[model samples]
Target: MCSRRRWGTSPRRGRARPICSTWRADWPGRAVPTSRNFSPWRHFLHELAGVQPDDPVPLDDVAELRAWKERFPTRLEALLGPLPSAVPPEVEVVSSEDCGRYRRDKIVFDVEHHLSSPAWLLVPHDRETPGAAVLAQHEHGLGRGKDEVCAVDGGDDGLREHIRTHRSDYGHQLAERGYVVLATDLRTFGERADWNPPHLYACDLTHVHAAMLGRNLLALDLWDLARALDVLCAHPLVDPARVGMVGLSVGGTVTLFLAAWDTRVKAAVVSGYFSSWASSAAVAWNMCGSQVLHGMLGRLEHVDLAAAIAPRPLLVESGTRDDLFPIDVARAEMAKLARVYDRLDAAAHLEHDVFDDGHRWNGERAYPFLDHWL
Candidate 1:
């Protein structure tokens, strides 16, 4: 037998009453309560706890490290889908100006047959010969893109404030220190942003579109950056052998992956984005589609991907108060990566600069690290 109780007031009593229900079987009576406090995200977190890599890459020795490096990037590239054929950048200088310690030139170059990237090339006045060059990447923001890193004047007050607060003008800083800096917009930003009717920040939309085509927005951007490297290396003022990269936030994501994939980047400074994938995934807005590797979660962690840059000079900057990436996880991940460097006998090549702040660039150690390595 089953009994039901209506919520609120009982019809016969015409007054408020407690609600209850019960069910009785052949043997006895029992009641089961329904819960209203469950969350799907909590279930997902539960599932994530059980997931682990099928074959975590071995870092036992130099042979294993070399073998892993040989095969991992190929696997990663395959996951990213096809890349556009390499072609001569066919660079064009659009304009130039004196900017205190460096001369900034506006240039455009082809990354694909139909696609081009706009950039600012900062060449220091004091350099007498070919010197180190750095690919300076910018974080996500309103329409400033490359301009933020190069510290171009006369943008909106918000942009100016962002630049000041984040210490984001590192490209300009690199120029002042005598390194040639190439600052460019990754797609769907600054001049590359969608300007049509019902315009929106297009990273999510663009990432969806690329995924439909079995491509990734990040892979596409990395290709563009590689071409940008070609342009930087070709510059008479730059020594191709002494190339490095520095970036904050989303820019740091690019710096980490690009330096890992392209050995041409002799040293790298990855700021504000080195925490584990699991940590980033815990926050919904932290992992963007553009930065996603399709099946990478169980197959690897951020440390595994970062280990590919082992034996190479890498400086990671983490802010103690960076709630997005979480400095605690960054420290743990860096410790894991340090083991890989230790195994490779390149322990000195790895450095972690933990500063007391939030998500932003801290060049105190980075500038010196790059100077010593590159």
Candidate 2:
């Protein structure tokens, strides 16, 4: 039997009524209510998720863009909540080893007072000059975490399969190209995944605790990621002026938000997760609590928040058949980004590639995009 449930986005109103898929099993072959005849609130949510939402682009001018940077983050804060300010991340390199073309240093660093991050710092072997760097991000690969991007030994088989299937080892690939690459486990993945929650769902509890502590998962992750920027800048072999970031799935969510919040990122490649938040989060219901920014729909959609990264080099990559993040919505967001960049006279800095593939990392334009921007 299908259980009936309702969700309220605002305190006084239920803005959407998303049906559970349980009905499919309750009546094996009976025709069900199509999404076409969904309630008005659900349709509104769908419109927000699709290209039909009313996000009239703000006029492109120096004044508006400047004001947007200041105002937009504040509005986003209303959804994602407050974050601890940036602090010196006293880094501790735990171990180092040569891996042929590069040496990987396993390290720990503090994001703020209470939390610390474990990361792999990949440096070009037998090199000395300061060069560009990338804060490579990891996706939600069935179950694989940061290792999916770093391709390190001792990773779980699922992430290993994720590596083989998606060629998700962009961090190692970038390090071999002579750029310092920092691949850190996000809040609830890899080393971070093992949590002492009072619930069965560890990831869900972490995000819940984050929200109860006055912020959502995205806010907390971005705060720590900005601190990762501090660590990247402090490294001897990294040129502080030329830092970029890349991620495939949830990692792309971080790349988008972090680049929007932290100005230090000079360039970014967001793969697999640049769709309309509504399209992916509202419709598919495939997002983790870590991806939630409660009630983000009313203020600014994905494209509006991304405008904070305008005038900087950014490349959005998406696959045509990605089940989680549909390419159709990705193009809509891309078009909005292009309009904002074109108005700023920095159109060339923004590029998006829709490759003919599925929901995986297609690194065709990623390396070149960073090379040109950095």
Candidate 3:
């Protein structure tokens, strides 16, 4: 009355006729709620069809793995750019010679993306028909140089030092054992980079964005890896079916994901990064960096991702004293995966090499596994 507007009022009691009095008659019975109770099977099918699954789906089945892969093409584009084109580079062996008992070379290529993923290909001197090929993945801080790529003597200086001192550089030793070896640099690392901030793992977020062009920095690095594989498989002397990958630390992380995502990778030796998520949760330095994607935990655990490689040949190298990822948790996770592998009757395919040291790859244990599987 005070010249004020009245508040909008609800229908008096229950008596404002429905918006459409006849609308109720459109259905023969009281409206059935369109939403149904949650069904796990339906969710599984939806995820299988490229619709993201509800927060979690049963992780043990091959069907789920296939479905999760289906979701990637759609989701990856939003987070990472289109899959990098796979234009096999014009591989040319620029130089070749003997490095001790092994034959080594400086191999160059004009990769499609101009990524400059050069490598040193090594083979046992005068050996033919090697059992397999091992793509030696280098560690985080080092750029892949000849010394880093072929660290046969086990001395220090980036990856070369890590491999040489550890007696692993499986690239060098594996070649000596008649296994063809291809050791190359991931995108932002090694001789591949002509300027500053040499490695991706150590760079600032801004650097990642500037270099990778809206791609998840880690994903960009791994894509380079897949492209490298494209070249290796084409090698006339290499046994395409007997291919393996091995590395330490972040290299281990790549080893893990590469084996899971690419079935063509028949075997792998992952060191310095095998401990369980629960164990990794404690150590401050153990966490690789802020870039470890936030969504990995919300959806899949490392163990689950490891299990995704079940029935395939996988060798996890863990450090008993390593603070990065706890040893006990790693073993427990391995046991969980063993059950799945057992179901597939390929239980022998999964193995763990527990070393007495911390944060390093145990090369001795790893080499034999490659010899056996590849």
**Clash totals for all candidate models:** 0, 1, 6
Candidate 1 C-alpha lDDT tens digits along 1-374: 24554447879989965455532232234434465437788886777777787555675676877788788887777766788888778899999999888899999999988888999999988988998999999987554789999988575788889888999999999999999999999888777876422544477778888888878899898889999999998899899999999998889988888988888999999999999877888885676655776776787667776888878899999999998899989998888788889988899999999999998899999999999998
What lDDT is reached at residue 76 by model 3?
32
Q: TM-scores of the models, in the given order?
A: 0.87, 0.82, 0.73
Off by over 4 Å in 1: 1-44, 59-62, 195-200
Each model's lDDT comes to 0.84, 0.80, 0.66
TM-score of 3: 0.73
Candidate with maximal lDDT? 1
Give the poorly placed runs of model 3, Cα more than 4 Å off: 1-81, 141-146, 152-164, 194-202, 205-207, 210-212, 276-282, 287-291
Q: Where is model 3 poorest over a 10-residue stretch in terms of lDDT? A: 1-10
Model 2 has how many clashing residue pairs?
Answer: 1
What is residue 217's positional error in candidate 2, in angstroms? 1.4
Q: List runs of model 2 lying over 4 Å from the truth.
A: 1-56, 59-66, 85-87, 155-157, 195-201
Give the winner by lDDT: 1 or 2: 1
Higher-ranked by TM-score: 1 or 2: 1
